[model samples]
Target chain A: MLLQILNIVGIVAFAASGALVGVRKQLDVFGICVVGATTGIGGGILRDLLLGVHPPDSLSKWPNITASVATSLVVFFAHPVLDRIWSAVVLFDALGMGLFAAGGATVALQHGSGALGGVLIGATAAIGGGVIRDMLVNEVPLLLQRDLYALPALLGALLVVVCESIDLPQGISLIAGTAAATGLRCLALWQRWQLPRARVKD
Target chain B: MLLQILNIVGIVAFAASGALVGVRKQLDVFGICVVGATTGIGGGILRDLLLGVHPPDSLSKWPNITASVATSLVVFFAHPVLDRIWSAVVLFDALGMGLFAAGGATVALQHGSGALGGVLIGATAAIGGGVIRDMLVNEVPLLLQRDLYALPALLGALLVVVCESIDLPQGISLIAGTAAATGLRCLALWQRWQLPRARVKD
Candidate 1:
């Protein structure tokens, strides 16, 4: 029941984030929904594909699709209201990322994916959506940018793997992983942390 | 034996096209290989995922991976020579696209995908790779642009569907589909065909 709730909220939050980007880029309503849905479920789709899940859970679940589409519609119409609560939305987005990373790692581990595959698939699930969204708009993905986005997700995945290695309780690991990733992301946002870049002329 | 030959050639041709794009972007050798391999096998991977084929054929097949990587290395070293025969490369790329489209449709049909599913999956196979390569490089995918790329692929897929509905020989359908798609693409190149776009002032 708790996992179901988190899935719904994560889908909505990610859909809202993609909808915001689509609106900023001046996409049509259909285009906005496409981007929003892709962002909401694309990662899970990739993870499922890699792990050999047929039909993919996200694609087969009507409620998940409906939630993402409805959230995109709400975002499209409620931009002015959303603007006021932008910080809260950002927080939710961070929480969504943490949940996805940890959740993906747990899924892969349960599927008998190796330790390396668990962490890699976990990170892929966290950032794949945003990378795809940026690609659609012809912008550099924040993953390769200075943002400390990927690192937190990786840390969360790695932590989950560690828990599994030590036979720790699944619930304990999941909660801790989410907290670790979300905390690091919020701190980076607050401190304006950035990775160093090479000083080469393009 | 003939199908194997075509698969090898198709992978190499697509890899070369991707490698050329990576070269123009001035990516490192590793990055170039990554882009090339994605372009070569990404479409197949997407098609397999959509069709619920586990372990995607591209990932499991070592020869396919080796061939694409070797072709990327060749493109990286022999770019100047490749530039002189760029027209030839474009021709082969078109042929590869056609083969992938028709071949993908046949596979889907065999898998019991309906007529619509077959065509859509086939087009997905034809364009999925380039979309992914562009995504990795942070470029707008060519599919959304004015290029006459997707229509020909769709046409090929449609032809395959038609043949299947009429119970035609597989060999005839495959050849006819490939010829139609490649012919249209070549003609478009010669005439510089483009899709009309909405002119909204940004």
Candidate 2:
């Protein structure tokens, strides 16, 4: 029951973020809904596909799609004040990312992926939807470039694997993993943390 | 035997197109190779995943990876003048798109996807790679916006389904599908064909 709630919340968070981006980009309602739906479920779908899950539960199940589309439409019609909601959206996005990273690792481990593969798959699940969302609007996946985004996801996933390896309770380990990722992301957002890049001298 | 050859050619062509985009974006060699490899195999992987092919042959097989990476490297090192070979690249890309569309639909039908499903999967196979490539470089997928790209792919896929329904020989039908898609795409390139879009009055 709790897991289902988490998934629903994650869908809403992700969908809201996607819808906001679509509005910012001036896409029509249909385009916004498409982006929102893809962003909400793209990661889980990719994770399931990688883990050999046929047809992907997220795709097969209607609730997830309905939630994503409905949230997007609500956001679109709200005529949101971008400055007011942008930070809140980021917060929800961070929460979604953290939850997804931990959740995805658990799924991968259940499917017999190794520790290393679990971490990779987890990060993919956390970030894949955002990547798709950005691609639709022709922007660089800001998830990859700016902020300490993927690192937190990896750390969270790793924590989950570590907990599993150490025989910790799944519930406790999941909470720890999500907390670590979410905290780190929130801190990064607060502090404007970014990884350095290699620049060739002109 | 013929199908394998077609897949290999498609991989090479798609990889070349991806590498060229990387060069245009001025990405580093590693980035270019990543883009190229993804472009070569992404479409097929997506099609298979959606059609319930577990682990997707493109992901499990090394030859696909090797071909894509090697082609990318060759293209990067060759450093050909763009104006000289761009038209040629367009021709090869169109051929790749056509072959993959037909090939993907055939695979879908064999796996028991109905006609409509087969057509959608076929177009996904044709365009998914380029979408990934463009996403990597942060460009609007020129494939979608301009030119008769997707329409030809859908038509090609449809042709394959039509032939199957009519009991045409597989080889003849595949050939017909490929020719139709490729010829249409090339003609569009020559004529600059594009679908009309909704423009909001300023």
Candidate 3:
């Protein structure tokens, strides 16, 4: 039940980001839909493909696709109203990051991926959508920039793994991961947190 | 030798098309390179992935990548000059279609794909680069248009498949396939060929 909720939130957040990027890029309705769909599902597609899961969930699952498309349309027609609810957008995105992070690690674990592999997969799943979104929009990936972006997902996945090792309930681990990721992302945004940059050589 | 030559020619042609689209989209040098690279190699990547081939050839075969990047740089600096060489571009592109069609079919057959699958793969391999390029530029895929974009590759694959059934030499079959595809493409271009469009219900 919790996973399902998080999945919906992630789809909505991803679609919203995709629509915003499409609007910023001055793309039309079709373009907006493409970006939204790609952003919402790109990471999971990559993960599933790498795991040798044929067709991928994004293609096989109707609800995920519907959610992505619906979110894009909503954003397309009502971005001004949605923009007024910026906190809601951030909250949705943070929820998505945590959900994807946990989902990725869980899937990788099911595939018999090692702890390190799970961590990597979780991180990839969390950020893969955003990377594809930025690429489609012809912008440098937000992942390449150092912020709270990938780190939050990493910590969330790590927490999930740790809790699993100690025999904690999966639901609790998932919720804890979501909360950690959300809090970190909110803090990062509020504080304008950035990673240290390398000094220019003379 | 001929397949290798065709591959190089196809990569260059696709690269040129990618560069042209990038120019139209007002992308920077990096963006142009991305478009060129994806256009030159995206189909092969998809094919390899579906075939469960790890890392994909484009990642491991640096020469093919070099060909794409070099072609992109050339197009970037010499757009004006290359624009005047339209006939040469078309001719090279035709040769590329012929070569890649055969190559895609051969690879699929090696992987035990059925005759129909081989044909589909061949057609996809031939036009995949252009499809990706169009998507990246936020345009509808050129292959989906009324142009005879995918037909030459289909014919080429058909010839190869027919020859294989008749116990013909592989070399001869490849040559025959290339000739068929090239002739069809050239004829289509000369005749200003187009597929019939559906009537719109107003």
Candidate 4:
């Protein structure tokens, strides 16, 4: 039940982000919906594909589709209201990222992926939707260029793996993992932390 | 046997195209290889996921990876030589598109997809890789903006559906479908055929 609630929250947050980008890009209604749906479920789809799970959970479960579509419509119609609360949106996005990273790691581990594989898959799940959304808008993915984004997800996934390895209870491990990711992301934002970039000669 | 050979040919062509793009983008060796592999197999991966086929064929088969990596390396080192034969590359790309479209439609039908579903999946398989490659390099997919690119693949997929509906022999249907796509693509190139676009007001 908790997992389901978290998943819905993440889907709504991600879908809103995608819709915002679509509106900014002046995409058609169809394009906006496409981007929103992709952002909401693209990561889960990627994780499932990597784990060789066919007919991904997102497609099989009707609720996910509903949540994403509903969020898209809301964003399309209420951009004026939603756009003003940019900080709130960012907070929700960070929370969603943390939840997704933990969820993805758990799924990967359940499917027999190793610790490293779990971490990679988790990070991919956390960031894959954003990457796809950015690509649709013809922008570089923030995951690739932004500092401290992928790292938090990776660390969160690693925490799950370590906790599981030590036979910790599932619920507790999940909460801890999610908290670690969310906290780290918030800290990075507050500190304006950035990853180093290579210096190229002009 | 024939399908395997066709798949390899398509992989090589797509990989080369991806590598060429990476080189043009001035990406490093790792980025070049990443783009080449994504372009070579991303379509098949998408098709398989949609069809509920897990652990896509490309990941299971070593040859696909080898072909993409080898092509990436060759393009990185011998770009000047490859660049001089642009016509040859274009021809091979057209052939690959035809084969992949036909193959994707066949797979979808075999997996119990309806005619419309087959057509959609087929075109996706033919064009998904290039879309992904372009996105990785932060460019809008030509599939969306370019007129003739996706049309040929869609028509080829439709042909496959039509042929199977009439109970045409499998071999004949595949051949005819592939030929239709390849011929149309080549003609489009020769005649500079284009689809109409919406004119924006200045």
Candidate 5:
């Protein structure tokens, strides 16, 4: 039940962020909806594809579509107000990343992916949607350049793999993984932490 | 046997186009390879996922990866020469678009998709890889703004769906579908056929 709620929250957050980008890009209604829907579910779909799960659970289940569409509509109408609460939006995004990273790792492990594959899939699931959303707006994906974006998800996924390998209970492992990711993301935001760039003289 | 050869040609053409774009974008070798590989196989992967075929054949089979990587390397080293043959690249790209469109429609039908679904999936299979490649390079997807790009793919897919619905022979249907798409694409290139744009005063 908790997991389901987390998933819903993640979908909503991702959809809202996508819709926000769509609005900023001055996209039409159809374009906004497309961006929102893809951002909400694209990562999970990609993860499932990589893990050999067909037709992705996001498409098979109605709730995810509902949540994404509803969030898109809400953001479309209330973007002016939503834009003011940028910090809150970032918090929600971080939460979503944490939940998705943990969820992805768990799913990959269940599908018999090795630990390395699980971590890669988990990070992909956490960040892929945003990457797609950015690309749709003709922007460089934040995952490639943003400080501390992919790292938290990778660490969180690694934690999950380690916990599972040690036979830790699923619930505890999930909690630990989520906390690790969310906390790190929040800290990075607050501290203005950034990853070092290559010192190549371009 | 013919279809297999067509698929290989499509893969090589897509990979070469992606590598060309990577070079133009001044990306590193790794980035070039990544873009090339994705452009070659991303569409098929997407199509299979939608059709509920897990572990897409592109990943399971070695030939696809080998072909893409080899093309990427060739393009990376010989870009100066390749750039001079822009017309040939365009011709190859058109051929790939037509073949993949027909192939995607056939696969979707075999997987029991309705006609509309088959057309949608087919167009996706033909164009999704290029979209991903363009996005990775931070460019607007050519499918969205380019003249007469997607229409041919849609038409080819529709032709395949219609042929199957009318109980046409598989060989005849495939040839007709491919011809419809390829011929139209070639004509568009030769005659500068373009879709009408919205008359918005920008």
Candidate 6:
């Protein structure tokens, strides 16, 4: 039940991020919806394909598709108003990342994926959508660019794996992972944190 | 041996198409190469993933990737000359769609995929790269918009299925399917064929 709620929340949040990008790029309504739906569900779809699962849950489940489509429609209509609360959108996105990362790891674990596979799946499930979204929008992916995006998701996945190894309660582990990821992302943003790099001539 | 040669030709052709789009979009050299590579190989990647094949052939085989990357770079350096011959790109792309659509259908049939599944895979293998390229460029997918793109591939797939049912020689059938698809696309272009649509009232 808890996982389901988190899933819906995560899908909606990711959809918003996608919609925001589409709007920034001046896409028409249909294009905005395509981007939103793709970002919202792309991760799970990729994960499932990798796991040799066909017609992934996102495709089979009416709710997930409906949620993404609904979120897309909402963003289409309310983007102007929502632009006023940009910070809130960022917050929700962070939360969604946390939830989905944990959920992906949990799903992989339940399917008997090994510890390493679980962690990788979790990370992919969290960051894949955003990478694809950025790629589609012809921008350097945010995760690869700044603010410790993938780092938090990787850490969160690891935490979940550790909690599972120790037989910790699922709900508690999920909450802990989510909090850690979201907090880390927020901290990175607040501090303007970025990956270390040396200057290279182009 | 002939099929392999055709495959390489098709790869180079698609790579050129990708490079053309990238140049028009004003992407940097690196971005252009990425788009070219993606446009050249993204569809097959999707097909492999759906088939539960790991380390997709395009990624695993150095020759294939090398061919695509080298072609992309060549296109980058010779953009002006290439642009002058750009009409050939569309013709080559049409031929590539034919070759890949038949190739995909053959593989799916070998794997015992149903008729519909084989047709879907065949069409996807043909246009999937274009779709990915369009998505990355933030444009409406050409497959969903202009040209009778999907229809040609579908017809090719059906032709392959019918040939197999009638015990036609595999080599002959494959060639026939490819020719049919390519010819159909060229005819469609010549005739300005389009899917029916209702006028939008807005």
Q: Report every candidate's CA lDDT.
A: 0.77, 0.80, 0.72, 0.78, 0.79, 0.75
Estimate candidate 4's alpha-carbon lDDT, on a 0 to 1 scale.
Answer: 0.78
Where model 3 places Cα greater than 4 Å from the true spot, the runs are A1-5, A84-91, A144-146, B1-16, B19-38, B50-202
- In terms of docking quality, model 4 is incorrect
Scored against the native two-chain complex, candidate 2 gets a DockQ of 0.12
Q: For residue A110, what is the lDDT in candidate 1?
A: 85
| Candidate 3 residue pairs in clash (backbone atoms < 3 Å) | none
Best by TM-score: 6
Q: Write the per-residue lDDT of candidate 2 for residues B1-202, one digit (tens) a residue.
A: 6666777788888888877766665665655666677789888888887887755667556677689989988877775544545555566678888889888888899899999998999889998998777767676785765668899999999999999999998887788888999899989888887678889999
Angstrom error of the Cα, residue A122, model 3: value is 0.5
* Higher-lDDT candidate of 1 and 3: 1
The alpha-carbon deviation from the true structure for residue B101 of candidate 1, after best TM-score superposition, in angstroms, is 9.0
For model 2 chain A, where is the 10-residue window of minimal lDDT? A193-202
Give each prediction's root-mean-square deviation over alpha carbons.
6.8, 6.7, 8.5, 7.0, 6.8, 7.0
Stretches off by above 4 angstroms in model 4 are A59-61, A85-89, A195-202, B1-42, B49-106, B112-127, B136-138, B142-202
Give DockQ for candidates 1 onward, in order. Answer: 0.14, 0.12, 0.08, 0.15, 0.16, 0.11
* Candidate 1 lDDT tens digits, A1-202: 5556666776787788777776666665655666677788877778888898765677556777788889878877766555444464466567768878888888899899999999999888877777776677787776675488999999988899999899988887887777788789989989999878779988
Ranking of all predicted structures according to lDDT, beginning with the best and ending with the worst: 2, 5, 4, 1, 6, 3
Worst 10 residues of 5 chain A by lDDT: A80-89
Model 5: how far is B61 from its true place, Å? Answer: 12
Q: Candidate 4, residues B29-79: lDDT per residue as tens digits?
A: 989999988888888888888778767889998998899899889888888
lDDT of 3 by residue, B70-163 (tens): 9888878887765555465456556667777777776666676556556656665776676678777776554443256567888898788778
Error of 1 at B87 (Å): 18
State the lDDT of candidate 6 residue by residue for A1-202, as single tens digits.
8877877888888888887776666665656766787788877777786577753677546778678878877877776665344465467568778877888887788888889988999889988888877777677887766768888998887788889989999997788887788789989999997777899999
Model 1 B-chain TM: 0.91
